[model samples]
Target chain A: MNARVTPQDSALIRSARFRKEREADWRRLEDLVEKAEKNGLQNMDFAGTRDLASLYRQATTSLAIAREISLDKALLEYLEALTARAYLSVYAPQERLGGLVGRFITKSAPQAMRRSWFYILLGFLCMGLGALAGYLLYLENASWFYVFMPPEMAGGRGPDSTTAFLRSVIYDDDHSSSGLGAFATYLFSHNTRIAIFVFGLGVFACAPAFLLTFYNGLILGAFYALHVDRGLGWDLGGWLSIHGVTELSAICIACGGGMQLGMAVLFPGRNTRKEALRLAGKDAVKLAIVAAIMLVAAAILEGFFRQTVQDMWTRYLIGWTVGFGWLAWFMLGGRARQ
Target chain B: MRSPAADVRKAQRLARKDRRAERGRAASTILPPEGVPLNLPVASIGVRLAAQIADVLITTVAAVCLVILFSALELTRPQTIMAIAMLLFFVIRVPYYILSELAWNGQTLGKRFLKIKVVAHNGGSLSTHALVLRNLMKEAEIFLPGTLLLTLDQESPVASWIALAWVAMAFAIPLMNPYRQRLGDILAGTHVIHLPQPILLKDLAGEAKPMTAAKPGAKGFAFLAHQLDHYGAFELQTLETLLRAQDKFMSPDVHARNRRTVATIVEKIRQKIGFADPIPPARAVEFLRSFYNAQRAHLEQRQLFGDKRADKHHAADETPQ
Candidate 1:
């Protein structure tokens, strides 16, 4: 036991003693964190949870103290890792199921929509311009309809189609073998995939978002032009109005959401592109999810109401009501609380 | 391929690659609100790829299972069945990634298997928004390119070239970044890091005994303040590592070599610290272990007064022989 102890040995000895005293708490915290990580914090009792929090705080303070003193690497690293793991466990985002969903409905989604009114308007205007161009081009020359609309997608509907054929295609209510349920689900899922793609690609400077929305509007205008050429335009309008109002708005909102991403990258303002994108993503995702929900609603109307109700006035009434309802919801919903 | 020369060259290349890879394990220093700097070892690109491959396999299996389930449903109409299968193909992968990460605290099944996790770059809680954004970009980064590659041969030359370029860029994004972040991680402000594993060893404060012989009452060497000041925490840790190693389990030949190494280190420390005491051959390790304890205690205690002697290099010119 012959060793030269220095004047500072008391302080070093105190740190060693400190490690010995606090190690048990650290070990307990590690065990609790491991168990909680494996089987969730909810699995732990109230006493255990309180103990975990207290022990975590002690561990963090120990880490801060140990670093300043330049303690042994092992103890220092142990505390660092322990505190990090404990930090993640303690500060985990706690959202109850109903509260999360409720907040999204009443606050997040609508607020997101209102905030990105610029992008939404941009998306709609692009589509509107494309629709106008398509209408004028097809009206000038019948072949312009064929140029804008692909043969496979046109499905035998063209300028040459008779009035009776166009009317039957719209007002028809026969989907027996392939039921409306399957059809609805199919449309919902298909639109969802396109919506997601539009949302994803909008990160690439918004060019694709513009092109896709414009192309979609062109197809819609060409189809409308074909019906108008046969003088069954108003009847076809009723058929489309049943779901088109909600469906088009959804696609536009998806485009807006996508464009939001691109705009963030393009014009980051004061922050870096990544920072702006992350901030924009919070709202963009909300808009996207709400747009998807609208698609689901549109798919329901398309498959059931559009198929069952053949009355033109009733279809227009339902479609306009839905369109106005969405506008009102976007303009007003979730605003009062904030 | 089986020739000895070729195999040797291949082994050399592999060893070199391993060296390069070891250097690539960059650490992200996160200063939490507590103000302690915690170094998180970011996952290497190779491990990340392996995790991705596992995730891709799971997603592919899921897609196939969905196809089978849809087939079993007997939706007789080909069109409806086709639509459902097509939707399931793209839909399953996104939600699989999202739900797993959200459910498991930024760790998917593959990440858990590989012992890596997604962490926020800002050193805070992993946001649900970041998770969704990152996973959503997977569709653009991997799945779309994967879907395109399936029909690359049938596509026109330009389309095929464009598809190949997209595939290359998507893959190269992670490789080009120091943190190995794909476009998704870059945008989402997240990092994938290896889990921290700090194994606190038994402190060698006073545990110095002869390894080969049970020499009781061996001479205890005491280092003076100036002598202990010749080395610092780094040298102390190196000495501790040497002391903690076990030579008993090795063969007689290797055990002799290990003893030689320890003797060499003991002599070096004695020379460096100007210790004149004659340590017996049996107490050579005991001498080294005592010096390690004294040096560690000296370094830590000196640090109390803000004299952080990191290594012997810092002590060379500062203290005269």
Candidate 2:
């Protein structure tokens, strides 16, 4: 032993020795992890699972020590990756898709809606007031209809358009299937855009959401007045009944979500604003999801059934059914558990 | 025993300190939260922006492809075609972001490319709702305002100004925040961080080959196993960074800078671990290097024997003898 063993050389020798001692356990852990990755955790028996967990704990400890000792970067990195992968597999949520969707529908959405009922009522009031005001304004002067409905949107349904032309536009089912598909897509996009806008803008203190809700009601009111003036009020009712029940309610629900968000920011109560907002967001998001589902149902009705249904009575029946179905679901859904 | 409330307060205080340290920019270290043992670095603004740019490009390309496919179908109504195209853009494009983030574990293709990932702010697994909400908000935060601004030529003057203001606020929010979080991240309680890069170990002994054999009584310092047990992974990583940085530069100023840094670290480690060895100025780097190797080996050896070490403290609960 003529050669001098400096501290650096000794440290290297010690590290190499450590590697030799632990190499078998590391190799076993690596094999287990590889098998789990390839064939899923179910492939491992109870003992194997336990061993994997124990190995993971040991590897994490090794990582801590390696860091303390300033071990080789490569060794440290290997441990880090292995530990992280194991942690993910062990701790990550493992809900099946069917279960997740079922839970959301059966509990999450309805419960959220119930929690935010106050905001929903307020949204309804806002829309009602706007609709009444619009009806009265349109009754006072026909020109107010133009103010509420844009020319592009009106599609020649302005005050200047004849009653017969308006009637034909509503009753005509002569358009190509492609045209109907395009229209359906367009209406779905437009409604979705507005719903998202109201929901998002609610974060800005709920004013925009309220205003948008009011604006939507005003359009409906003005359109109703136009139909009444043409002596086709029943026809208009039938026309709106098929899809309006679903579409309008969805908008209202989305607006409710917006108001909920706004109120959280404004009030916050005992919690910090961030905490309050986070809590409110959970309920608000569920309301938005419910609103989206309604919109999809509405789009389907308008696209496939609205034009095809010739009898006004059949249309009203379908519309009222959907409207009542939703009402029942909201009021009674998830109430069994409570 | 500390009250639960006191524990909560302590955690909050630590969190605040960590946030403050992150804002300092010059502080290169990150301290994990109470339960989370990993210390991941937050991604830089430049990397985040690059990732966002990549995502935008992908979306645009997808939109263009849809438009071309629709046009080639030779539909009778151009208005109908345009409307359908717009509809597809919203329905498909929005979900693309949500699903990508969810499936890829908080990483979109762009984020993957930049090696950054979104993680829960509270150090929990990401939830589906959080993923959906954040992506949905992207419409309001970036896309809507951006599209409005780009179409300024067609918009009313008042509307154009409002759009401009919205876009400005969206762009500025991330810059002003310590975590560089956009409105979505703030609302969703998520933030992006840089993924740890793979580390390759170089042979430390091979590098020390130039040293001559030790003369009699010229003993190099050796750290006792107990002395090496004080520091943990965090300190080890910090030292590794310093060593790596030393090898990255060749300029005289950089060398001088590295020497100063190494000396400061050596002194800090000595004080921390209570090592009594008087390391000569020239031997400070070498001494730290040797200590690092020895400590790392000792830790690994302990781990194999089913002994665990969490931090500096070798508590009985953490590492049973």
**lDDT by residue (tens digit), candidate 2, A41-157:** 766789878888788777677667655553456666766666655554444333445676798888788888888888888878888888888888899999999999867668889
Model 1 chain A lDDT-worst window of ten: A1-10
C-alpha positional error of residue B206 in candidate 1 after TM-score superposition, expressed in Å:
4.9
lDDT of 2 by residue, B151-228 (tens): 577547877777777778887888876677787777687778776643335545334433423434455567888887
What is residue B95's positional error in candidate 2, in angstroms? 3.5
Error of 2 at B211 (Å): 8.8
Best by lDDT: 1
lDDT of residue B264 for candidate 2: 85
Model 2 ranges off by over 4 Å: A1-52, A63-90, A177-180, A183-185, A188-190, B1-36, B56-77, B147-155, B200-321
Query: Candidate 2: TM-score?
Result: 0.74
Please provide, for model 1 over B231-266, each residue's C-alpha lDDT reduced to its tens digit, 9 standing for 90 to 100: 767777666667667534788898899988878877
On DockQ, the candidate that comes out on top is 1
